[model samples]
Target: MFKKFLAIFTLTFSLINVALADQANPQVVMKTNLGDIKLELYPEKAPITVKNFLDYVDNGFYEGTIFHRTIAGFMIQGGGFTQDLERKEVRDPIKNESANGLSNLQGTISMARTNFPDSATSQFFINAVNNYNLDARGRRPGYAVFGKVTDGLDLVVRISRSPTAPKGGHRNVPQQAVIIEKIERLGSESKAN
Candidate 1:
């Protein structure tokens, strides 16, 4: 009986550790029409931004969204507009977390916002080149860098190279819609992501 109890306790402890490990730096995969982009979020560095993104992912908010804007050598932006160029309603704006020390380097994903700081909602962008200019500059609140592409970065580059034109009053809109099929957390039962 003593040996059996010890074995059960060890198993439970191991499972608990696994759960905590997964939560430490949760992984997600953004399924875009161009291709799949695997991302690793830095919850420790940008907890609020990461939580906001995960909340959208959990709610399937990105389904069928289009990578509306793509600028060569700049970045590919998406997650807010649909393929039809209609803007989706999003949750309230999140606080700026760009001072978390993360840079806007190539392959890194950052929250997309307007000229007004602290207005990032559901839209996000992936840097195609090192975009250090977007990093926090002292008092200026820069775009928040919450995650980076762990795999399929080549897909991001491809999306950035897409042909673009002005559409629906938005500039640099992709002529060919680059749709986001879905975004899912990596370690669920469908760990395929």
Candidate 2:
């Protein structure tokens, strides 16, 4: 009986550890010229989206991209280009996890996709308003919202309100583009003084 009880305890402990790891793996930081925007990724909720974003971060794919699209009261997008509008080649597209229960609410981060559902690559956006209409259940499959801005909504708002410059391109073209400059990760271990 004691052996059986020990085995059950070990299984329960292992499950708990997995849950904690999932929660801990979601934290991320976005450093921009405007300011630093800290995000908490939801790999458990949207594994594909999280993996795509983290892959870019890990490979330094977003190092010099610019926020090509910024619409006040709508969203701010980046992670795809340089100040001169040069596209940074990214890995093949990722599966759209829009079916995930997350919403495209204000301050939430979502993947930028084409007409198709599974076309999201390296580009992403943050909603400046509660965009329930963009949720997956809408007529369109909707953008894959994988995370949210946890501590820098003000920075996002500021970027959204910045003046835009006219540019010829595809979706969310800002009249005046905001350059991303770079993206870096900040964890507790790195913060130790």
Clash totals for all models, in order? Answer: 0, 5
Model 2 TM-score relative to the real fold: 0.81
For model 1, how does the per-residue alpha-carbon lDDT over 78-99 read when each residue is reduced to its tens digit? Answer: 9999888999999999999999
Give the runs in model 2 whose Cα sits over 4 Å from its true position.
Answer: 1-23, 138-140, 170-177, 188-193
Candidate number achieving the greatest TM-score relative to the actual structure: 1
The residue ranges of model 1 lying beyond 4 angstroms of the native Cα positions read 1-23, 188-193
Candidate 2: residue 27 Cα off by (Å)? 1.5
Output the TM-score of candidate 1: 0.85
lDDT for each residue of candidate 2 in 1-193, tens digit (9 for 90 to 100): 9999999999999999987775686577787767788888887899878877877787777876888888899999888878778888778998888888889999999999888888889999999889898888855688899988889999898888887766656555655556666655566512221
Q: Could you tell me every candidate's TM-score relative to the true structure?
A: 0.85, 0.81
